[model samples]
Target: MTTLAPASAKPTPSAPTAPTLEWVNKLVSFDTTSRNSNRPMIQAMADELAARGLSPVVLPNPEGTKANLFATIPARDGSVTGGIMLAGHTDVVPVDGQDWASEPFSPEIREGKLYGRGTTDMKAFSGAVLGVLPEFLSRPLLEPLHLAWTYDEEVGCHGAVALVRELDAWGIRPRLCFVGEPTSMRAVSAHKSSQLYRVTVSGLAAHSSMTPAGVNAIEYAARSIAFIRSLADDYRISGPFDESFVVPYTTANVGVVSGGAAVNTVAEKCEFEFEFRTIPCDDPKSFISRIEDQIAILRAEMQLENAAADICMTPLGAVPGLSPQGTRAALELAQALTGNDAEETVVYATEAGIFQRAGIDAVVCGPGSMEQGHTANEYIELTQIAACEEFLHNLAVHLSTTERNEQR
Candidate 1:
């Protein structure tokens, strides 16, 4: 009689046996949400780079709670200039309201998918880079291979903006930068720009029963938002369109709004956060000018009721778009490595735009999809990880054999 092993003794089909999954698990274990401190996670990655005989630089934020990481695997000739960069953001979006089948921070494998926050919205890409980094180090490289990871991308590209400034100061610029932002291993040469702002409307608070006695801040704010919607509708029906994007025209939305102390009182203050995502060719200033023009009209009307009434606008974040005209080298390289010849443009904004504006050629080519990102039970398919690994190894081989571009 054959002795049968129990079900519990059976091997887990979804266990993290793959090299890329191992790194993914290690990274996804940390909760580096946009609002939380990313120091611990950055330190762990820094330690890994040090262990491999690399001098990884960690630049901390003003509060020192968050950080950005930059490291390089120099070429055989010990040159650290004019090479390729593999980059990704460190922070994940908030999982506050989402109901997850698995714990967001504790990565789990099921059905050949690794489920966790940042798994698709880009820890997997970061993991893939780290997993293949040692291989790049072992090989004799013709040009340096650099790694860049930033904090607070989910909030905005603040970390990347600061990092690029620091890189500028150091005069450490890469010839091409591959920003890993979940394109399912395809290359995205261009992406839309993002501009977010906050508005605060102040008014006199009084009992709801007294109509017009107190300036209704919420009422005036509604008018401003209505104008913003009208602007969005105009864009939707207008001629200034780029058919390449999934959402061809520019988009405007009011994401967050908070006001009104109670149902029985007139709101004394109303605050709202709004954003505009424009195509690379679109002039964001025109959009802003129109919105401001409408807001000014409302502000004047609000003050008509009470001269003390006011509206204040502040810039929250700005991420410039990646224009296709400047990324010839990066496009050619990503195409060579992935064999993906499609002309791709993503509707989502990325740090690639920031890097591109900073005089570095950038392209988005990474594992997984945005469909799985920022949602409950977020997961990245095992196949995507394997393909990304293959791409990275191939990139290493190509870099090892190719000569550095002197034009950069």
Candidate 2:
């Protein structure tokens, strides 16, 4: 969780840069797991961008432990107003319990597969962007091109929330954005919304021998967990579904849990983390409203057992679903770039929706696959990287060829 802040003094600008493959390996070496601070990685990238004569802005969390980076490559006319923004989160999921074929943070390659914790999930996309920086710079762009590398995306897209605010503050609006989120080099036009939460329960503790003397927090927590499962089952049987999604309906899952001291002791507290991935047609507010009602009832039930007992649910973060309404141009551009005509959608969430919420058309298009992301021995086929590079190349060509006044 340790992070170093960006150096206060700016360095002299330089044009020398590394290749995309080297950038991918270097970025993967940084362990930016959700629980850790990504300030070091953000600062390093900022320095590189700044040295290349591009002004990159570093936006940090309230605590200043982590940060997001935004930079722009203007058109031949030196205008930074309307253009395309390429974004990717710098964070990777933890590799704690998974057994990797090679060191998780140390990048390795075997038989055309790059092995690393974030090789497939995100760093590859970000690395490929860095790799193609010069290509974007060399072209006579009609509109500006932007890079938005963010933090805490593995958690709840929190850093992107901040990035949106920062963009508004700077009065910068890109024509659209491409959120590179391991989509197998395809154009993804829609995805469900993702919301995360944590719940905690407290009760009076006593010896296990005298169950009547203690309010069992763990037992109370189980009641709420069961309630969550029941809601999931209810939606599974209901019809407010979007067939475009793989799950085709809303879903809830409790991913982590912990509590208690020992088997011989009555548990005084219990904590659990859960999330709701709601289809675009569903309302997450209604879902959270139901959860809050259940929390109030559970608190009352616990209080009846012991005056000191308590139960509470805290919202972690949320992102809205991406729909096709505003993505016409972005999808077309993606299709033109990748030469994929099929309309694709995913159940997983991405930062694309966050950008769309800011009135920017956004789509999910990137290298790698969800099958490889967040798994042991995570790797992206070298061919996927090649495809992404070609996609970027085509994008640069499109921007370079667009008329300055047309404003795509």
Candidate 3:
């Protein structure tokens, strides 16, 4: 069974004040899965920020079912210069199909580990930032520190895009950003981008005996899928050649395919969802265009047999890759704060790329391991929270020292 943290319980400072862990526990208690609404959690966070005397800007989606929160602690001298942004997502992946030893929504601590959905895949990082608010507030800041938490990250990098646009509209640009994704306390300077495409094939349905008289949508879909597989093979051979990533190259896969109603009937429709994780240097559009070109050729051939035969491709979402920025100063600061140097890259996508694209030198660095993210019994070690507290402490100290220097 899932163990939910008591929402009303005040955190004890003597209990090591793992603010991030406490925050993560509170976040996990809410069922903020990608398919469900995350407004409640966002509102809670906004209230928390307000209570800390920070004014939070809530950017809500058109439907008002979700939101992204952005807040800034201004420099003491009232300078309008760019500052550092700490980013994290408010939404988590679904736990519907996963088996678990405890309720995924209820956070539980066992043997120095906290287990719950979103514990590592990043509520912990957001919580950590919130947990350290007291210290951050107490400091005299030289440069502003911005906090940005977005929704719908699991669906795509959607919420952050909106938040970034809002910031742009307001003419608020940050110098650097730290995306607190699960990096096991290391700094990640790069990650592959994800581009998703959904292809739909429409054809005339007919009896199996008259299959030749009707175009088979399923067969056409199979041809497209085969071409995609061949493309994947070519990319595997060509290689992105990065030693940091596990695959070391762009990878494409068709994840879902659906069509047909009966065994004796000629299928009239087929749809498949495919995605490619492209290296930073690779153009995702080039691969997508290849698939489109192949589909066009196939459609032309099918049209010769049946004028109604058609194939269409629609883009679901595309997240840009994070290119390596030489010797990131933000990363160096994070390392000094955390006292760990285990830097690396990852195959999974995150909003880090978006921040980098917005011209904010960005790095992914935070607590916990990706291995536990989005899995059954998802967890973060208690020690990771302790380390994060120390990191935030160092950050606070750095802010104070920098403020002192600026005063002189």
Off by more than 4 A, model 2? 1-18, 402-408
Per-candidate TM equals 0.93, 0.92, 0.93
Backbone steric clashes in candidate 3, count:
2
Q: Candidate 1 vs candidate 2: which has greater TM-score?
A: 1
Alpha-carbon shift of residue 47 in model 1 (angstroms) = 0.4
Compose the digit string of candidate 2's lDDT tens values, residues 224-246. 89999999999999848888888
TM-score winner, 2 or 3 = 3
Residue 406 lDDT, candidate 1, scale 0-100: 36
How many backbone clashes are present in model 1? 0
- Compared with the true structure, all predictions reach lDDT values of 0.87, 0.86, 0.83
Q: For model 3, what is the alpha-carbon lDDT of residue 332?
A: 63
Question: Tens digit of lDDT per residue, candidate 3, span 1-408?
Answer: 211111112232323375566787898898988888889999999999999898998898999999999999988886545877889998888888899999998899988888999888888888888888888889887788899999888878899899989999989998778898988777888899998889999988999999888888899999999999999999999765677788898999999999987888888999999999998778888888898899999999889879989999998888898878653766666665565656678999999898888878788888889899988889988777766666666677776663233211
Lowest summed lDDT across 10 adjacent residues in model 3 is found at 1-10
